[model samples]
Target: MFTCLCLISKNVFKRRNKRTEFEILERYKIVLEEGFENGLIWEFYHLRGDKGQEVCRIYTQLGNVDWHRQNQWPEIYNFFIKNMLQLEENFLMVKEVVKEELRG
Candidate 1:
């Protein structure tokens, strides 16, 4: 019984990981389709599947500063832009990871 439980848990873990990877890839595709450089950010907040629920959020950078508020700090805007770039890179990496996992 213990061995069966362990196997079951392992399978569940693997499934969850695969689901997460797929979700990340899907989100990445959506982000790209939405165009990261078009002054619009694609954010995925809630991801649900058979394995469970996961949250994937990606913020795209806007080249214009027209949206900046008068009271907003310069550092905050810089950080936001940096984070957006990181998210875009992360999505690319995650897509490769998912492809490898699927191949294996």
Candidate 2:
């Protein structure tokens, strides 16, 4: 199992006289400097698309589709949520990269 962690942010934009749109923002990916068997790699990006509809797109190289839909994803989701919450708590001055050091 390749434990790759990716950060996905979905943004919905609404403006008068314009159709609503959604954007998936991916920031960066986190990976170990040296390969580690149990290590995780996370990637973040910014996505833009039509709003009010589910946006399903492939995240190439992130994981297998079956794996995301069937196994291990819930736990992965929880991990991402937890990390996000922690990051939000310090949104003012903390850099996302600091999470690596804090994990140590």
Candidate 3:
């Protein structure tokens, strides 16, 4: 029984890791589609499945800045606003808690 429990836990962890990798790839594609080019950074945290974060830095050929207050990429900006928590400037961090209950 103990061995069986260990196997089950291992399988669960493996599945979770696979899911995390897939999610990161899918979202990175979305970022590319939104015109993110050089300086794109992808980070994945080992938090709960429902908790995550995203940060974007704007550049106009000069390079990354401390902050950018304009919605230069409205589509991307709106997407972030709808999906993550918007902080000052163009930085966005995913909310730790989901606002709406997901349906099965």
Q: Quick one: best TM-score, which candidate?
A: 1
**Clash totals, every prediction:** 0, 14, 0
- How accurate locally, in lDDT, is each candidate? 0.44, 0.34, 0.30
Worst 10 residues of 2 by lDDT: 17-26
Off by over 4 Å in 3: 1-18, 21-33, 46-104
- What is candidate 3's local distance difference test score? 0.30
Please list all clashing residue pairs in model 1, or write none if there are none: none
For model 2, residues 1-104, the per-residue Cα lDDT tens digits are 33222232332122321111111111221222122233333322234443543222212232443454657678656555654443344332434554543344
Expressed as tens digits, the lDDT of each residue in 45-97 for candidate 1 is 44445545544433343343443565645645665666555555555655676
Candidate 3 structure quality by residue, lDDT tens digits, 1-104: 00000000123243555444434334434333244333333333233233332222222232232224355455444445532321211222221111121110
Better of 1 and 3 by TM-score: 1
RMSD (Å) per prediction: 14.6, 10.8, 15.2
The residue pairs that clash in candidate 3, if any, are: none
